[model samples]
Target: MISYIESFKKVSESRLNDHLIFWAKTERKGKSKTEIKEQGLNIYNVSDVESLIDTALERGELLVLDITEADRTFSLSDDGKLSLAIFLTDNFCDAYKAYSIEVDAFTEETKQLPLSKMTIMKYFYRGHSINMLKENLALANSSNTISIAYHHHLISNFYGITSLEKDACTFHFAPRLYVPPEWIGRKVTIEIEGLDEPVKLVVTSPYPNKRYYVAGVKLGRLNTANGFYPVIKPRDSFPAHKELLLRWKLDDEIRIDHHLKLNFKFTNSQGRFFSSEQQLLPDVAGMKKFTLTTTIDHSTLSERNARVIVHDIFNHYEIHEDATLVNFPMELHHSVKATSYFSKWYKSWTAEKELI
Candidate 1:
């Protein structure tokens, strides 16, 4: 049996969910249905981008697949939902094929697992070979190559406004919008409650990739006393200066590329500042599971204080903070590799379903 459910079906077929295969966005949206009764899937091959995909998710996104050129450009369009295929193979289509015995064996082990609703859906996306799909996603991670193409989502609401105690104050506005590149360098005025004079802050940074702004600066003054973002006061005690690991399941859209500039920050228990902003680049983008990063690895942290409040900083406004996950870097992907294949029975396949 090729699938986990198929093996399970020998004992009981009724327990499995109907394997609904969607090849194109149209089919997923209910505009099309399969007319031909075939056991195989209806998937769009990597070379064929038939649908009008408006939304931009770049894994070397393409109107057509080109194996020769490694270069790509960023553009914005006002189109509807984008439906396109990302190449699982970096250079060769043959690379995505089952090349070794280890992958095949992994597929067998997976099929033997307990049958469940979640597990069944995973097995279906592995195409003919489950192991191949696993390797497909691991392609970029294993190579130590940076994700040259990606983007963050439209960030809405998650932001922090901090008063840097008379020295400087910070505010994040347009909390939900992707600030266009043109807006940077434009000047804006922010009204501070305590200060009689409105703080004149320039849009020094425009971070649209993460939806919210990644960083910002208050022009007037620097606070010598202290600077702090929101902190997650520990419920239990914290260990001494043991380095903490942090990971972010970043919006898959945030592409870490040569052109992309990024920064991250967090504070130690002592209220001392630390940054590993540069260390996160292509590395974060290439992470298999969660993006692996280290916090202030110092001995000064105490029971009530240690590493906390991690952020994926595009700027101050784009700060998304979370507690450190010690076991950082989850194994890439367990399943769900959407591969397109050109079936020999295309004539009959087209007759059965609408493909537009």
Candidate 2:
């Protein structure tokens, strides 16, 4: 029997050598093209040739090729050679070698374990490993199917339960189940059947008096319908403060009502002295457009220095000063774009400086 390590090593070495040869051929052809260009003294560019050479050298170092003639039978198309050269130059060969080594180690470690345990471990390992490979390789979705199948196999083989459904996308493992005692909840173990490996699921019940249900299991593209399952934790509370702004455009005359109310409170570091809620009505009517402004008053820092945050929901912030305390008004205005269906009906505010 071929040892796991030896099998993996053979595959990795073969791939590496094939990549190296492909790169070498591409580099040679590219150099010949450059030579012809140089001899003809034409304006033919060799930048692409130089880039190919660089790629070949990078990939060549990672490949381990045999010096013997029989092992040098690998062949690739011209375009394929160039692409392989680029892949090798980008250190993809090293990444694959690393992955192969990891896989070998994992296989060796799990060799003595029960087949069920080994399958689960390999499923998890391959899932994470393939995810890492995807970050560097733009693999097609179809390529992921193999890994999903492997995971499903592990689950089915380990559990003895035969009723498991494969997802349409072929990237998930789902197992369904139904149990009795609809009023008393209990922990349950789910096993997926039909794999060469072991797969099990452990679920805890949230309600002690109610019977638990297992609705479904979903992993990636794999979804299984088991039944309703108990949830251990409940949801949380809502936020106390949330500010939202809506913009509206006016095509014709309209009446404003008290229903248009802005309810909010503001406080400083000291306490809540400026806590006030009020409804705002349209002060201007029969106009082309106007903006509604809501200002939250903080507190007076000094006689001439009062801090107030003014916002109109859609537009930016504008800090204003009290003219009674200062001789001049110092206003800092910041504007934000309003994303509303009525934005076209509103007029843009004039850019100016005011003291507040």
Candidate 3:
């Protein structure tokens, strides 16, 4: 007799019904109809997947059926349940090997068994020694074509911007670890902290989410988010009553030479906050430096550290947390055209005077 395990591979969910039907029909041509019916297997061509599911529910012997999301027949319960396996279809074929896993089944009698689990896998085994026939004829309950790597994931830390049309831009951002199976080929909406409109970004690729996974989204232009970038590292030490140097940049194209308000926050290891605000008229570009006297009395010889977050006065069109477009390509600004606006130098603030 042909081994059930070998027959199982030969008759997967796709051709399971056809193989059973053929077995019944071929035997009927030789034997009488009553003799063929004695095997106690009924074969029928159902109208849809739901009807096929109904056939399974009515008769527990009904084994396999292929289906999509359009419909469902019976919902599973405690007494009877279904194991939903999601897999990328191409991974299974005759030439390639299909993965097999053995799991314990839970039932009234086996409730106290050591390895008992709720999931139910019904099967029969017959063999001896190492060469045993293991038949695992199961239903193709679900299939996901997109292959996602579950083990490989990383929290990404980057944002993106792409130029679109006149006065309009597309901002790309991803929140933390973005799984490709859930993100790719879909449009999602997210609310940024400062931007007015609910931003929408399409996930273009999958990542670690870091191999440029970007977890980053793309937002179209409406009201841009507010931006606050620290230009220079604040002076970490206080020389009794000496100067405290701090600097910042804004992301607004508005050429305001008027003073704007800034609130600076500082926190020590215990998360206690010390805050102060200053008003200064920035240059044509929103950039400014401040040197103030502080009597907060800390050592100049020893080291002290504080966390910092700076907030600017409200600008309705502020581009939050991004300033790259403020220094746009020079060609866009020049009447005719100019060279690309590249960064003059790497940031060397608080470095040696010569480097500055």
Judged by TM-score, which candidate is best?
1
Candidate 1 local lDDT, 1-356, one digit each (tens): 12332222121111111222233333445333453314223434422221212122233222221112432222222221121111222222343433323344553464421222223233333443554446543563553221110000001111232212222211111111223345433333222122222223222223324322222223123211111122112313222122211121123333121111222222212112112121221122212122222212122122113333323563122222232322111121121111111122233345654555
- lDDT tens per residue, model 3, 182-252: 32333322223333233343222232222111112322321111111112122243111211121111222
**Candidate 2 global TM-score:** 0.16
Backbone clashes under 3 angstroms, per model:
20, 25, 13
Ranking by lDDT: 2, 1, 3
TM-score of each: 0.23, 0.16, 0.21
lDDT of 1 at 349: 45
RMSD value for candidate 2: 33.0
Candidate 2 lDDT, 71-130, residue by residue in tens: 321223244344533443343346545654564554345331111222223333444564
lDDT of 3 at 77: 29
Clashes of 1: 20
Candidate 1, poorest ten consecutive residues by summed lDDT: 148-157
Q: What overall lDDT, based on C-alpha atoms, would model 2 receive against the true structure? A: 0.28
Model 1 stretches astray by more than 4 angstroms: 1-25, 28-123, 128-131, 147-211, 216-322, 329-356
Give the top-scoring candidate (lDDT). Answer: 2
- The order by descending TM-score is 1, 3, 2
